[model samples]
Target: MDCNYIRGADLSHDSELNQKALAYHADPKPGKIAIRITKPFMTQSDLSLAYSPGVAAPCLEIRKNPDDVYRYTSKGNLVAVISNGTAVLGLGNLGALASKPVMEGKAILFKKFSDLDAYDIEVDETDIERFCDTVAAIAPTFGGINLEDIKAPECFEIERRLVERLDIPVMHDDQHGTAVISLAGIMNGCHITGRSMENLKVVIIGAGAAAISCARIYRFMGVKEIYMSDSKGLIHAGRNDLNPQKREFAASEGMTQKEAFENADVVVGLSAPGSFSLEEIALMAPNPIIFTLANPVPELFPEEVRAVRADAIIATGRSDYPNQVNNVLGFPFIFRGAMDVRAKTINMEMKVAASRALAALTQCEIPPYLEELYGTKLEFGKEYIIPKPFDKRLIVEVSASVAEAAVKSGVARIETFDLEAYRHTLAERLA
Candidate 1:
């Protein structure tokens, strides 16, 4: 099949399917998530204990020691998934209300994957200061704040200011989620291809939140040379139009996206569909790692890349393909670990640990059930570069790794941390 034809076909969303999605959201429930009371409120005595008189005791204790809120309330296990609806997935800006479903979906994922409760807060304000102020003001109610769907430049500032201001763990999953998961795939890809991080020439197409975060994390992973491109082409040293975030990944010389792919060891496509072609993929160094992550349609499809360079290790943001770099693998579990350890912030150490853990999990033997489910043996090679989101091991592996990192980094508030016991706790929670 012609790749362009496939790309074109994928772009058109079926109205019938769209309506089905809408119906799915509407029927039996108006939204994806709802608040559930953990304690009973059936009797008058239960009500008094649940509220007014009985609540005042914990309130008084919490007033004396602020940290007691975690003990007395659901704050420790609760996370707020806040979004402005500015950048709702690949759909672009659809405003705050329209972004509710996606936010609710995030909450569902949090509950399903980690047993953590999340409330989707769609902040209508677009102004950076107001948005940040609003979240900061309401920050104390939850153990962690998950900033979602906020656009870049402003997103950078919002997350930065929030992290500096709030004591609880704050993370923009759009920025770091893709980065962490992609980094895990890259680590495995490098290992399989016999390439080192230091020598790789990484070309990141799109200087948006994900791209910038990936570039930053790659740098943290000891990747020295990174070339970045946006809608205006290459973000190079000579470009005065570059924002501060883009400037961090700017190369010495500006080049077209096609030119930037020359001899590139890794190509990360976070831009629109058809951003890169098969010819460009052919130009990459031998055993290239290509993460054409543009959703619905990638820059170049897997078949097109394989036709050109069979040695290429390919990944995308889609689930129907092999080595899918889904964010579901990262955010839920990362937050689970963070909240468990009461981490102050989702720092670089925690993120690196998560990536390493994910990469390591793929190398271990795949379970017999998983092999039967996929109808093929799963291994740590080209097609199976990272662990599947449904893989139950992720909860134990990634979460524990992140929790351990948080404690070791001194960011964890809790004094005592036991790794094995924590793993068992996670297993029991899942059970």
Candidate 2:
């Protein structure tokens, strides 16, 4: 008998990080997430109540009144992280099975950061209709659906169809998560520079999902002058070969790449590294806000940007840097609030509310522990424009803000919505 026997035990992968990651995933029971029973089943009575006799009572009650399902089951706290592997991180289209690890990681974040139970659903279909239908079919199983990592244009339609068809919260985290967090930083940056949202001229280096969503959310924040560039450069009226999403953000007068970046107040990079030249980024106005958000590699690094223009405020997707516009700062808590309020949809109002809530947290007194944890003094400055993901107050403040917006926007489904009481309940999750 072999003591260390396991499937593919002899097989190995290359690189130091690969080995460490492989062993970490394999030795930790093959996955990053697992489900746990919230109910007791220690005896025959417990079994009868959990399954056979007592379970029937809640089932009948739910059948009699459809909304009773939220009262009787875990659906109110459960979110499905659904994805098609078309655009899984920086590694594109690795297919459904390959995206499982990412989905599981997302589920774990949902649990650890916001106390939400999540199941990762990797759909094997890419056809927009089939994908949407599959997600819609399983929609009833979750209180909310977080659409993830599907390629753009298609993801837009998929989310649209599901949000229209289902009576639950639906959000494409790839789209709105970055949007929400980035907007928070933008809000703080503008305040620091004394720039008004309506007067800001924004240039986006990618026309993908996140960039489009950022443009949409910034519009809600009253940012009017937005120019987006795909692989073809600035999305402008002269381009006959533009998709609807790209066309919507197009500038009426086609401008040169230099013209687009020149005097721009903000620039966001959602594409790969070197998506724009240093000279291009250098063309921005004085004290410009630059977010090079491409993961693993940004369009331009902080040092590079600083060398060219020291006054420019910079943000990246990397955690090692200051003012990281991470999605973790948005999704879990956003869903937590939305589900608690039984929101019909995660509307623009809720998103803007969450962004403002996050921006506000940076100005609040920093927790003593965070300064010690990060080995740096944290405050509302150029270096600390957004709250850290581990901040205990996030689940309380962000969730409460989203809930209030949900209620005020007329999207909440529950009766007697109490914002103060809901804030208390959310705070207990940290306690």
Candidate 3:
């Protein structure tokens, strides 16, 4: 196949997809989501109950107990999708107003995937203290907070401050969402390739927010020897220009991209397209786990990887591929589980549980209904190490695991938890 022909076809397809997306968001109103009244409002009696005299009853009760706010209102099921627009998906520093569409899109996914209610809140403040203050002031309105599209370094500080100040589940989806989903796929890849987590050598091809988070999660999963790279080169302790976040993942030794890939068990590409060459990838161990998760264009294409090493387990951020370690597979279910338990925070335990749950799910018997949805037979293998985003069992398995983890970790406010019973409820949400 001619490379130019493929590039031309991809360009035309992208143009058509973008046009359709614009039309879809425009015709149905100027947004991808909207509020819907869930209660009766036709009669004067209903109006009174919805507000004024009758509403004061629940308000008074909530004021007395404080915790009764969850019982009286929708706070326990509501999440705020927040952003300052500095890192709007591939389009950087577009400002708050421009990130509304992406934020709204996040809210809708929460509703569609997990039966949670969400609102998009775009903060105009860029200063770290001001941004955190604004979000904390409005934090009471939601059971959880999803920080999105804010640039790194600032994002780290904002999330840290807000997490300490608020008593709800808080997550920066760009970091932890990518972490959980990719970790799940990598876990399965390790299982199938006869590799153990502790012994594996990892070369992460970016040192940005997502890349840093991925390194942390890999560490939690018992992976040592994680070598990360930034714009300059491999992140080693000798480098003087490293950010605080990048410095955390610094290796004791420096190596070329080629030397780093030599016998490496896994390589995660979260940087820009062509960040590393295919020749470097060919230096990896047999049956290497290759996750090139850069959106729109990966650091290395699946085809390009396959041409070099046929034993490699491949995944990309794109849905058109077999193993897509996409964030949509993580956030909704994670928040669903956390909010259900009234978790005070989305701790690393919950995140690790969610990723392990996803890995276990991939090896489960694929239901006929699920296979029918994608028009294919699904199985656990190198090609299908990650569960498809459309798999319905995610709500049950992943959510239950997250909730259980929250309870066990002592972050959940709920008095008691029944794992099986909770799984049943999650399944009912889908039904």
Candidate 4:
């Protein structure tokens, strides 16, 4: 027998950091997430009770009464990350098979970060109503529904209809999740830079899910002066071909995007790569806040934008940058809070509360763990406007605020508890 065998793998002899990295990479298989038996040490009697004969009692009861599934099965702890492959990130529409990697990653993040058991559902159908019906029918299996990467306009209606049909919290993560984080970041950015939301004139590039949602959130925050644009220039109130989503956030009667940005206090770029130029961004008011949240490549590069306006506060979606308005800062924690109180739906009240919580965390005094991770104390300023995604305070501070909002808004199924005590428990768990 010809076999090439290693006698000993001395991984521990390597440098500590290298050993740690290697161990993490080698410990799990290619895709680390999978199902395993929860009650592994069951005896034959336990197996009979859990499986064949004794299990039939609950099964018969659940068959008679449908709502008992949440009591007997894992339905209450599970979420479905459903997607139709029309708008899959920067690499648009790779179909269901290719989109599985992203869906799987989302599932892992949901499980890892929020302690929610998530399963990815990639549908191949192109018809929006069919897909919506299919998902709505299967909604009983999950506590919540996280819709992802379905194309816009259609996505808006689909989400609306699903929420109407299902009793569970139905959200399109690409739309609502991105919007929640962007609003949170924007609130922090404005507060840090000493700008008032009511007086700020903002311009949003791209009238897609993220941009439209951001505009709506801003409007809900009482910022009336906002403008948005798409490929065909500004989405004004009178645009003949404007979709309903874009039309709701359209610019005033006679203003283009560039015109709105000419004296704007904030310019948010949710459009495609290289969409905003230095000259265009330079047209904004003094010390303007700019969030170029396009992934992989921002609408304007941070260094390039900084060259034009040195005092401007800048943020992006990439982790390499200082202020990353990444969805990681919001989604996991938002879902955590939502699930905790058994929220029937994600309403505007909950979203605004989450944003306020995130903003408040940044404005509050910096904690020791934050100082350690960031290598210094965080303050409300140009460079340190938002909390980093890895900040330990998120689960405690943000989730508690969100849960409180859920209770106050009357969407919570469970009774609310002491906010301080809840935060303390969350702090320990996160720590």
Instruction: Give the Cα lDDT of each candidate.
Output: 0.88, 0.88, 0.88, 0.78
Candidate 3 or 2, higher TM-score: 3
Displacement of residue 386 (Cα, Å) in model 2 is 1.0
Report each candidate's C-alpha RMSD, comma-separated, in the order given. Answer: 3.4, 6.1, 3.9, 8.5
Q: Write the per-residue lDDT of candidate 1 for residues 303-357, one digit (tens) a residue.
A: 8889999988999998778999999999999999999999998999999999999
- Residue 431, model 4: lDDT of 54
Write the residue-wise lDDT of candidate 3 on 303-396 in tens digits: 9989998988999988888999888889999999999999999999999999999999999999898888888779899888998887899999
* TM-score on alpha carbons, each prediction: 0.95, 0.95, 0.95, 0.88
Q: Pairing residues by index, what is the TM-score of model 4?
A: 0.88
**1 or 3, greater by TM-score:** 3
Q: Find the candidate with the highest TM-score and give its number.
A: 3
Residue range 1-431, candidate 2, lDDT tens digits:
00111112212323565679789989948999877888997999999999998899999999999999989899999999999888777556768888899899899999998899999999999899999889999998999999998878788999899999999999999899999999999999999999999999999888878888999999988988998888777889999988898888889665876788999999988887677888987789999999998765677889999999899889999887999999999999999999999999999999999999999998999989989989998878888898998898999999999989999999998888877888889888868
lDDT of 3: 0.88
**Per-residue lDDT value at 415 in model 1:** 83
User: In candidate 2, where is summed lDDT lowest over 10 consecutive residues?
Assistant: 1-10
For candidate 2, list the clashing residue pairs, or say none.
none
